[model samples]
Target: MMAGPRPNALSWLGLSAVLVAVDQWSKWLAVSRLEYGNPVPFIDGFWNWTLVHNYGAAFSFLSSAGGWQRWFFTALAIVISTGLVVWLARTPRSDWRSALPFALIIAGAIGNVIDRIRYGYVVDFVDWYVGTWHWPAFNVADSAIVVGAALLVVLSFKSPDTTGKGG
Candidate 1:
């Protein structure tokens, strides 16, 4: 039997809303409560809260690129988010494994874009790592993006016959 109408659009919008809310809230709290680089340990060495402003891409790729990267990254995010929205709209909601990741990525992208536009940088917190090998500071939006990307990688490996085939 043919599948009913796809719920991709609804799922995308719903997930995006959740991401946006959580991302914004966390950023707000980070800015209001945490001082820059002052680690507020949650589990002492495993996790901590700290505020950081990233003006460039992941791991501060263009962070020291003489400041032009701010607008460049912002524009890139807008373009990417637009494309993801279109992709999400075209995808069938029944394909949850695929659509869900796309929605998450789109939401995460939009969340960072909002910060870039409003604050000129993304506020990062929630540091995690071992003794000295600290992971770069990041926020909820980054987490969503990373998770979504991981899901996409997993979905990419799934057999076509297995996807969207209810067990």
Candidate 2:
């Protein structure tokens, strides 16, 4: 006897679309309203809005490697986003743990790819700091990617119950 047809998580793409819209809108607003390199304090000492352009990967990796990094990162993001979409297609609809993260990552990857293709760099604006130390400036896309990747890591440890009795 074959198992019944299982629904897939492709519907989760809706969430991806919403997140991508938000990421792009926030980037646009930042580019329109924020001054480059000038920080506008949000929380006095902990957060600020500072516009910056990233020509490389996370933490501005390979940012100074001249001009080739732009296309490289763009292509890389496209490939990764494609893979995540395929994975989501194969995942069970009930598995929100996997589906949610996959959707988040897809949104983030596509959002940044749009920036790279249009501007040759990703727009970053949010800045967080404490005292003299500060985290690298980033945007909504980066936040989604980080949160999605972190969810993947944390969820990986949750093992499904093998016993007939559902836990």
Candidate 3:
């Protein structure tokens, strides 16, 4: 039997919750402490805490799309998060490799969703730079999503069967 749902499923969900909490907390800290358009250097050459808002999908795609993209992205995130939770619930408890990435993705989706619902934009603060060149500012949720996507890429090469568990 499936034993209903494994204990580790809850554990994985718990970890996802932690990621969401941390992501939200870090965003809160940035919002409270950082001044908009001003970069606070965290590392001399490479990193800075800079506050910005993303109203679009990754890399600000559709950010310029009037105003509906916020709702579009929010709905998309909810759908994806629901799907990930279902997958996480079905996965075997011992399957850390698969569960880890799905959990991260869920956390990230929800984190951004909260932002969309609350402020209509995601609060991003991490700024990476090289002298005059700069990467777009991003936040913890963005980091989680990227890490999860990267893990999925790595796992895909390691094994063709990468889906977590059930429907």
Candidate 4:
């Protein structure tokens, strides 16, 4: 009889849970404590807490598309989250480099999905950049997704499994 594949060591689900909790808590704080567009400086020139609602994808991609984007984004998020969960389950726990990113993406997707389902948009804050060239406002969930993507890109290049090697 062959033994089952070794289970993953890292808890991708647990990491995802933590990301969701932190992301939601941060959004709650932003909504309750800050008024929209009003900057509450946290680092004077580097960071600020400014509440904003995004009705579309990254950088407000479809925010001005007249309103069809709400459902579109919602559906996309659902699909992405589902796919991430499935991938995470199949990934070995020892593959933290890959699994963590998937977990973060999953958490971020679910977090934004909650907002879209509840308010038809995602709440964003934590602004950064120079005086006239400000980056789009975003929340903890967005941050996780971006960081996770970057990490995934880096890991893909480093991992032989991802690079398609066999011996």
Candidate 5:
């Protein structure tokens, strides 16, 4: 096996930086260009740009719990981000399956944390619906988080062994 520092590694966190920048830029654009509580259809029957603020986690789980969820989520994101940093540092560059998901998670968690700190809530804009069954509005950060989680699930199934060896 070839040795001496794996090539094109993610330890530098370049992709994480890009994801975070793109997420924050998109959110900024949404806030600047879109009207709150208004649904601007991007597709006839699939998607739309509906701006909304979420005060809690996925699907606004604790959105109704006064305003304390803000700090709670912020702290949680920080902790998660810290863990991701450690994972990224320890992860081998060749482990794209793990590294990509970890970077994505870091981008998403930190992106949402920024919103929580700046506005006390997350700025959600992407909206999808089918007839009256509408999905909750979410932003790029949410998308990254979901995709990263899905990728992690797929990786788990792809390699049933928990050990990072014997491939």
Candidate 6:
């Protein structure tokens, strides 16, 4: 007997769309309701809703590099997101381990790219801190990227199944 056609993970794009919508909506809310550079406390000395803009990559890397970084980052995001989308199309539908991460990273990359193209900067609002030490302010897209990348890293270490059973 011949094997039938295999299902692809393209359906998981729905998750990406939902995530992008939520990311964009959150950024819109932050822009509309919060004042730039001001911290609105969400938790006592631990968290805040602070509106800020980042012109570069993670943790504001290269953010101050004269005007070119905006287009550079935007193009980079487009390329990365495009590649992941292609990967998603090739992935098997049953491989949630791979599909989930690809979907999340795609959503995040596209989400930030939209901001960069429209506003010349990525909108950031969430702020976490401890005492005087503070982590960088980031948005929903950044969170998704972080989680997705982390999952990819963790899953990469899974040992192969020895019993010939697909895992």
Judge candidate 4 at residue 26 and give its lDDT: 93
Candidate 2 residues 4-70, lDDT tens each? 8788999999999999999999999999999899999999999999999999999999999998999
Weakest ten-residue segment in model 3 by summed lDDT: 158-167
Cα distance off (Å), candidate 2, residue 78? 0.7
Q: Locate the minimum summed-lDDT window of 10 residues in model 4.
A: 158-167
Clashing pairs in 4: 8-93, 9-93
Candidate 1 per-residue C-alpha lDDT over 27-106 given as tens digits, one digit per residue, 9 for 90 to 100: 99999999998999999979999899998888988898887888898888788888888887787666777778887888
Alpha carbon RMSD to native, model 5: 3.9
Question: What number of clashing residue pairs does each candidate have, in the order they appear?
Answer: 0, 0, 0, 2, 0, 0
The TM-score of candidate 3 is: 0.89
TM-score of each: 0.90, 0.92, 0.89, 0.90, 0.88, 0.93
**In candidate 6, what are the lDDT values of residues 20-121, reduced to their tens digit?**
999999999999999999999999889999999999899999999997999998888889888988888898787778889989998999999999999999
Task: Report the C-alpha lDDT of model 5 over 1-167, residue by residue, as the tens digit.
Answer: 78676454456478888888999999999999999999999996989998899999999989999999999999998998898888777776767888888888888999999999999999999999999889998888898889988999888778533575645
Query: Candidate 2's C-alpha lDDT?
Result: 0.92
lDDT of 6: 0.92
Off by over 4 Å in 2: 1-5, 161-167
TM-score rank order: 6, 2, 1, 4, 3, 5
C-alpha RMSD (angstroms) for model 1: 2.7
